[model samples]
Target: MAEGGIVRVRHCGAAIFCRRAPARCPACGSPLRGAGLPAAPVRLPGPFRHGHRQPRALLLRPAAGTFLGGYDGRSDLHVGVSSSQGVVYNYDEEGVHRAETGWEQCISIPLVQPDMFGLLQQWDKLLEEFSAGEDWLPHRYDEHDHNCYTYALAFVNSVLTAQGKQQMSKSEFTERFVIPRTKQASRYLTLHQELTAKDFYIVPLPDGENQG
Candidate 1:
């Protein structure tokens, strides 16, 4: 199992990850099952570490101010991909940029486990060639219909094709991968804000919220 990774439990349809695992399921209070009884939860890395350490990752950052700067309690994000060299490739109003800086404030979602796709050596080259393609031209950028998310998704699909895997549509990818991770980020942000503003944060739950 990956260190501090997320776990999905089918027994109670619970997806929970934390620093320490409780003896019983936090949701249903059942004995934790699986190879790792106390499976570690994902610990979201600080931006500085994530940018320098996580290569071949899908990265997200607040589109405007810092994540905590959100007034409406939601994040509007910009998406990018990390090259094998740890440089970030993202599309925006200025077109695709190969960036070494400015990614120190992003979240990382791994595109694959280390060396899983057998393309680590060619990752940077592929990103460069793809970003230079006419489809991602600066003039073609659009905020809503075609934007950073589209650019990142396109690159991901290109890699999937090369890996001989079925390519995912935007909706499919967003629903399965992006949504779950983003939801986790949102929860983290909310709790952080609450704790920062007070001695402790008490999350008010709906009745039976933890019943599973």
Candidate 2:
């Protein structure tokens, strides 16, 4: 085993990478470090390379009541526009806000990566339209009509249309992608028994004091 390096713990013939050299394995919580110990390979960061970086669209789900909680279980959607360097734009209610903590889950949308400059220009144009009190920015937010879900749908469709791709509606996107992804993530935890494991834990907050 290498110091401060990745390690794997084997239990029931199954093994998983151990983030740290815990006193017991994270998988089975057994004190068997050398039982299935194997040499870990060294990984080093590489220099940045120039290319047409993929543009990402992340759907962020925050805790309930973080924004207006009505339609879906999730509160709001934050679109993260990223490149090779890192996240360039984290579009939210504050309008092109910087990426920060607070999101509970992030669902990525599948779309062809467009030119970085072109994408930036498109976002800039959208911001201009928003500032001009255009149709892009709904006058008010309604649960069933206008809300964060609608805003995200509009933003994504705008980018897709600008890239000559077919547009999608909020319902279609939610049913086909968002809902299914959320279910999958939920199932993963249950399948792994993370909710009942002795070592599994989550700090609880006082009632009425929770924030997204």
Best of the candidates, lDDT: 1
Residue-level lDDT of model 2, residues 1-212, one tens digit each, is 22223333334344344334456545456665455332222232111111123334444444343221222433444444333333334433344433434332344453434556666555645533543444433345455665555655676677777779899977787798677766654433332343233333233345453322
Can you list the residue pairs that collide in candidate 1?
A: none
lDDT of 1 by residue, 76-186 (tens): 787889988788899999999888877765668888776565687778888899999999999999989889999999999998898888999999999988888777766
TM-score, cand. 2 vs. native: 0.47
RMSD of each: 7.7, 11.5
lDDT for 180 (candidate 1): 80
C-alpha lDDT of residue 165 in model 1:
88
Cα lDDT listed for each candidate: 0.69, 0.44
Clash number for model 1?
0
**Model 2 regions more than 4 Å off:** 1-8, 13-31, 37-56, 63-116, 130-139, 175-197, 200-212
